[model samples]
Target: MRTEETPLGRKRRARKINRVLAETYPYAVAELDFRNPFELLVATVLSAQTTDVRVNAITPALFAAYPDPLAMSQAAPEALQELIRSTGFFRAKANSLLALSTRIVDEYDGVVPGRLEDLVTLAGVGRKTANVVLGNAFGVPGITVDTHFIRLARRFGWTNETDPVKIEHAVGELFEPSDWTMLSHRVVFHGRRICLARKPACGACPLTTLCPAYGEGETDAAKAAKLLKYELAPGREELLKKMRAGATRAELRTEGYGLQA
Candidate 1:
């Protein structure tokens, strides 16, 4: 457990950490593929306990079959179940998706609601899901307290709380509301790429000096570099090399990695 520091000291550390993360992950955005708000909402709901890669793979066919709330709300249960089978929790997810679409079609006139309250009221939608939809789709600012955010927030000394709501409120107080959405992306990006749950790449972390939990992982450069997530292997290294050479995020995207973890 970390000793509580002065509030002002903690804020300073958090600000520096935020800045470093922004620089490191300039192109951090939602990794899930979506053409619009409705697609994003469904994709996010299916993403529970699964990876973005898997969700992405399934969504193309899923969306093609039922492209809108009206269409999706009427989809056959068995068909929907089989369609999303590989995403895990298929039956529950299908039920939620069907119910969610039905509610949108019935209540919101076939459009995904923009407000956080209304979004959360939809089936399978929670605070985290609502925040993701609001921030990415509707331009509303919100903090998404995912597992990555929870872990990194404590490691960075921003908040000691374990509850997602408490962690969201605590960190929300430190940054501007507009920064909340992107802050989530950067922190999640760092968490996935460097500050992994089991073993972090401490020596290779750009924010090591600012991090309170600095020595928790391998400190040797070679070993630390090897600790990066599998997806970040050759691509992340190449991306970093270009970033050092002053590549814009758009340029990096052209070179392949513009998605968030």
Candidate 2:
């Protein structure tokens, strides 16, 4: 941040950046595939130090065997551990899951609590995990200060706080509480797809004029475009364009749209 920047200046800048991010990634949401609060809680717990894609891959079988708190609470330790083995730290994660599930069943009647206070009391559930569950599952708003969020928060000059709790509170003051959850998604999406840590696609970014760290990454349009990574990948927009032009899935697949590694 420059010496001339005020708290008000930072606040306005933060909101503006989020507006651009919201427009750029309108489809952003929790990447973890889950149907209910219990599933989301379980997925979030397993997501520590791992990618959502990896967690999503294993949840199907894990859920198939133990779909709820009561069932999961009764799962054999080894069986539960094996189900989530791919997410790494399987033993510790299994312990958390078992402990939390048992607590939920015994205390909360097998239902995931919606309030942050209660949610954080469960094993393996911290503020980040609690916020994710509250925002996505219960429609309660919260800021989730994960790694991506933390990195982007500082880059955006939203806050200087290094602590997750402080970062969450600091950034939370910049936008309305209602914007908290979606703002988190948008910031994380931008971090993952554009304002990356090592090689942000600066020239391809929508917020180039607003970003203070504009020249920190690739600046040439062509080079920055190549640096872009997204769920749609480079082929996503092309596929969407062709689809909008009336291309069918089978036809698109034949055209190699879904064949990327």
Candidate 3:
């Protein structure tokens, strides 16, 4: 994927790679389980330095205790810490959630702001976090440049920029705004399940020919199969078959899928 080409040619190839990913993971989403904007805002903040599984495990309790900005704004620091202890950096995260909740209650009238500009103003919310909230919660198109997105974008020759904002702008130029949110989901899903940072399952990946960094990990199909995670893991065929049969992501979530958490 990292090859010499005209700017237009590179953009064309990038869209093609996105198409392959779209096919590979038809059930792609943010992975975090949140019912509304406030939950998503808090979850995305807690998601830093942790996996979605850990965050999801704790959100239910956290939300049960403090379901909204007004409620969370008054949460006891010690209680919040205990609830989110598994996500790591609990103290810092607790402070963030408390501060942001207070701010939302005071400033936004207990409603999570849907605009990116307003979202970024909250404590612990950056472009990535704001984008997640804007895209998923508000139906606003945004490119979330998380670690997985940055690595895969560079490897796919989509952009040479290292900064998240630069990468977002560069990649955003390649696809329509309508494609931004879904494209982010697809790229992150591929990175999590196949194009792993340390041991990518390149052989099992659909974008092998489109990936410039192919063969950086095990390229043998059988060996690569062991490297897959989540829905692509061994013995997960039924999930894949169901997805192929037009199962909605919500339907899979209801059936006790691992990602439901």
Candidate 4:
């Protein structure tokens, strides 16, 4: 059977997906913990192959020691590496942090540059990191196509490109500039929670009805059940538990249950 393409069909599906995602993840935000542009740059650098939680844990000590670009620039490479050791890629990250800090101190007058091009010129700062700092720290609109965002974009038929830059362009075309930062966070959240890489929980995913990949791997009830069973593994269980607790507390407060009990 040939698939029918209609404007109404596409619009309805898109709207439904957006509405469900917005409602389900009303408070979706960047998980990276940073207070300023410099901190964000450092955190993003440290978070290359590491988890944000690990990066966050390391940043407190690192930031406390250095605090700013000048201080970090002057910091010993060994000292910086020791501070960021837990975040993995310590040697490379330390070098990047030191080099980037020196550039900020000498070139940018100790301020993180707001412009995307200028930000990317810093050592170890790619488009994704630059975008994160620009959008979140400097109030600039830029699309961040990290692994999660990239994976989801491809899965959702937002783009077929594997290159991060291409994916960013494709997404920018789909959504407004104002929604760039928040949209990245939302896609990342959805990718991590429901629309996972290996076995997506399409049945429970808020965007499944809108996703073209939905039910692609499910040919039988038993296979679907097996996939769902794998989704409940210990690591997934822990993540879901934490997310559920946070959501439950927010819901309770919104419903005035917090005041009652």
Q: Highest TM-score: which candidate?
A: 3
lDDT of each: 0.88, 0.87, 0.90, 0.75
The regions of model 1 sitting more than 4 angstroms off are 1-4, 234-236, 239-261
Which pairs clash in model 3? 1-212
TM-score per candidate, chains pooled = 0.90, 0.90, 0.94, 0.81
Compose the digit string of candidate 1's lDDT tens values, residues 117-229: 89989989999999999999999999999999999999888988999999999999898898999999999888998999998899899987788899998889888988887
lDDT string, candidate 2, 204-245, tens digits: 889987778788899999888887775435757876467446
Clashes of each: 0, 0, 1, 0
Tens digit per residue, CA lDDT, model 4, 78-97:
98889998888899989999
Question: What's the lDDT of the predicted structure labeled candidate 4?
Answer: 0.75
Pull out the clashing pairs in model 1: none
Candidate 4, 76: how far from true, in Å?
Answer: 0.7
In model 2, what lDDT does residue 256 have? 67
Q: Which of candidates 1 and 4 reaches a greater TM-score?
A: 1
Candidate 2 wrong stretches, greater than 4 Å: 239-261
